[model samples]
Target: MSELINNRQERIEVMKNLIRQLHEGRDEEKVRRQLESVLQEADYSDVFLMEIQLMEEGISRESITKLCDVHTKVLKKHLDLTETPDAVPGHPLHTFLQENQALLQRTAHIRKKIAELEKVSEEESADVLMKIRFLLNELMDVDKHYRRKENLLFPFFEKNNLHGPSTVMWTKHDETRSYLKSVIQALNEAENISQKEMIAFARLAIEPAIESVEEMIYKEEKILFPTAMDLLTEQDWYDIYLQSPEIGFCLYYPEFEWVPEGGLVENVEKIKASDDKIHLPTGSFTLEQLINIFKTLPVDLTFVDAEDTVRYFSPGKDRIFDRSRTILGRKVQYCHPPKSVNIVNQIIKDFKEGKQDVARFWINFGGRFIYISYYAIRNDQGTYLGTLEVTQDLTDLRALEGERRLLQYDEE
Candidate 1:
């Protein structure tokens, strides 16, 4: 904590010990005091090393995630935006920072609305609820921000063996997603909410959800981004930038065109790399043929692997439900509305337990009878593989009382 111990390695060790103490039930005030004292002489790298050391001590990333923002709140003064390096336009980091600023403005506006709602009468609250719902929808875009981090940025961190923070941050993302879902549900369930109910909803749902998002923004800027800047090279960042649009942008767009060096060559090589045939027991097909066959299927198909990560989805011309590359490798639970996640979990559990091999649901949507069925994809030995979700619009099929054996296209 003294200037005499200002050697980089010594400072990193002190910071590491301080973090371990904080985690091991040391007095919070004492640890914070020590951290503050160290920050006076500590370079930012010392703090980054602290995070790496904490994970090295065998602590779970989930546990670290809960503590990440707490410690960062204290370090905010030390890691000023003015002092941290700048990210260029179109860079993934720059886009994220801009989105956070946009989110802050939007959240501030919602808070003002919530303040006004405190005085409204029960009879007049319905109009206010509708307005609040729109604001909540805007805030819901946070998912795209978090998803890009999980799918694009996190993988690079893992590649460098900096797995703890990525895992920890993803857990926090799930928490924020859960909170957002509850806030949406609170708004949707009540048609004519009373002033008291509206205030209660704000207290119970809105504030916490927005606060979770804000805290995550702080963590990313104060700790995650700085460390990542030091860890990732230009090529690593370019790799993420190329994949950014797949998950979609957040509240802002990158106007400048930025391309990675050799990016086109790398992509072309990937395309040509899989030209060999894939042989199966029945027969063999080239990769291109297999891709076309999946796309040509009448029903939209999605395969969620045993790990619950989406491994594949067919690109039908008219998909019953929207599917995007963003969904590739994403957790199946996050793909659905949070309300239905429990039902999805139950179905997966039943499949794993061998209680059921299939689950089907049909709903009339937009005058179309949309049939959705989930089948447990398994091997001949009966081992659980994953879930295959097949969806089709059956409006025309149901109306047909008789089958026509011959194809006649004169009507066209």
Candidate 2:
């Protein structure tokens, strides 16, 4: 009950105890009151460290995610955002902030539409629902926002040995994605539905989706960004800034350019040092040529080494599946959803045992026919090396009537 606030360790312990009380079914208001009385202000890092410590103490990540919002609400009042570090106009955090602002505007518009739908007559309800649906479609751009954070930002935190917060947030992102998908499906099926029924569905499904998105915004601004700003070095942020364009932005584009005062020192040096040509048994190419070749390839290629870790992925302009450099050292199984992880593991298992050389599947995704294939790579001695996953959009190819014998270039 008595702890020194100035001591970082003591603060972490106090915060962790308060969070455990919330998780153990204790009265939230009472615990919050205790928190307010004991801790004058909630430091962003303390909140994350508390979660990490709680996990170390045997609490599951799922439990932490479920209670994430509750504890965040409790700590929200005491957070001093004004003290959070400032990010310059072109910094990655600055861009993220800009994107969040744009997303907030979209969410505000959707909320207004929902409010209008509640008061509109049955005849007018359909129009209101249509507008809301359109807004939801626009709101789906948040996926890119989440992906940027997941793939670009989370890696730095993991490198610092701070994995708990990112893990919990990723689970929340998936939950939000699922809710958005379900609500969109419900809206598509509400053709003949009555105003009352539509409003009920909105409350049951749509509102939660918006709420989840807003909750993440709060978590990022108040907890995640401030913590990251403190933890990540100047060089680390510069690296993220360089790779950000590859994954793209969400709802906003940064107009300002930011280069570190000393410029890209180590990165440029590394590039110069690695500019030599690489020779293979059959052919050879410079590192730059090889990189561009991969980018120009028609298929999206991913290589998972024999250890099941993602070693490389091609970043073609029109990729069939989204991938980021964060996936480089991540396990392949973590790349898929929980339900499909078993299938992924089985494929890897069969490939390792020499039972299969190739596996293929095709699915219709958002009206596009997608073909995915996995092949086992081996050496001359038949030693297993890795799995190569190739994905392609086959919609146009599937619809081709006849092959053209004449050379032709497709118009842009």
Candidate 3:
């Protein structure tokens, strides 16, 4: 007992010294090696707090990136101790990573080609602009990666009371998104860019976006992931694994199967079956059926198609705005208040003209505030049907929180 106590005390001292060094920005490489060695031998719970302390002390991004690979190796080794097989190819997470890998590669290729084209004379710049436009369209896939984390992973982390790191990471994600959008806008408007201008844009816009993604991976592997591994059960991970494919990944490829720990393989099939249905009070329905049901909802929905026409609308419950049957055949402008008619017409015209797709307005009425938004509805073919007008009451829906696991019946 005395020997074990002494050993524990020694490990504590080592952790404190390493953290001090990292905080002081002294010998980061040596300190990182020592930290990794400590992690390999210690219980995760013992080192977890110290690791967070180091992170709080401003560890270098380069150090974080290097440690990410180390953490992956450690996780793989630990996971391999279990008898479960690896996750299959085209598994949700796997597919996400695969898709994002292609996007990242394409973005890099486009950047390189644009750089080469910059060296040519002014007459050849048009070809470069065309290439940049193509790349911008491809780079829009960044939204997929952001949505996956925000929609899927963040919820799980929030449930575990790990909000601090999650919030920081989310803020970083937004910053990266803003940078990408700025670059895309600049690239679109740029008629002639010299080599220096292109290089500056690449540094300011493209590289930062990539670095942000890479840094996120670092945080995930070292902090968010380990916390998740500790807090979430195998079932939780399986659920995430199942849903991940929908949102996809960013520059990732998985080499292992993700068979849920201690669960039967058939469980994956069951999850897939249930995932295909939308559960409602009355009954479950297929995806297409659910979409149609939402369209037929009690409130009226008017969609400005990609072509900036009134293409589709749904009737759903408790609609805040009035949608008359006569408005169905008319231009979206005629449906609005005359005072705001010009703005509506302008929004529609711009959407059809590919200038803008979203317009929003809100107002207080009948002792309650209402929020209304118009989203340009476009299909995969880039065909604009019209704008979707969604208007909802802000009173009751804004108060939702916690889990609603039980059923409540309401009689008409």
Give the clashing pairs for model 2.
none
Relative to the unseen true structure, what is the C-alpha lDDT of residue 384 in candidate 2, on a scale of 0 to 100? 96
Judged by TM-score, which candidate is best? Answer: 2
Poorly placed runs, candidate 2 (over 4 Å): 1-6, 80-84, 265-412
Clashes of each: 0, 0, 26
Question: How far does residue 391 in candidate 1 sit from its true spot (Å)?
Answer: 1.7
Worst 10 residues of 3 by lDDT: 78-87
lDDT (10s digit) by residue, model 1, range 1-412: 5555557667777777777776787887778788788788776656656676778887667667767776776566676642545787877888889889988987898888888787777666666766777666667777889988898888877888777777778899999989987887666666656688788888788999889988888778777788788888878887888777666666676786565555455663664676668889999998889999998998999999887767788999889898766456556765675447679899999998899999999998887999999999889999999999999999988888966789888462
Best by lDDT: 2
Per-model TM-score versus the true fold = 0.62, 0.65, 0.50
Candidate 3: tens digits of C-alpha lDDT, residues 272-327: 67778888778889977877787666444676544333444565555666543323
Pairing residues by index, what is the TM-score of model 1?
0.62
> Which is better, 2 or 3, measured by lDDT?
2
lDDT, candidates in the order shown:
0.78, 0.83, 0.59
Q: Candidate 3's C-alpha lDDT?
A: 0.59
Q: Measured by TM-score, how close is model 3 to the native structure?
A: 0.50
Worst 10-residue lDDT window, candidate 2: 325-334
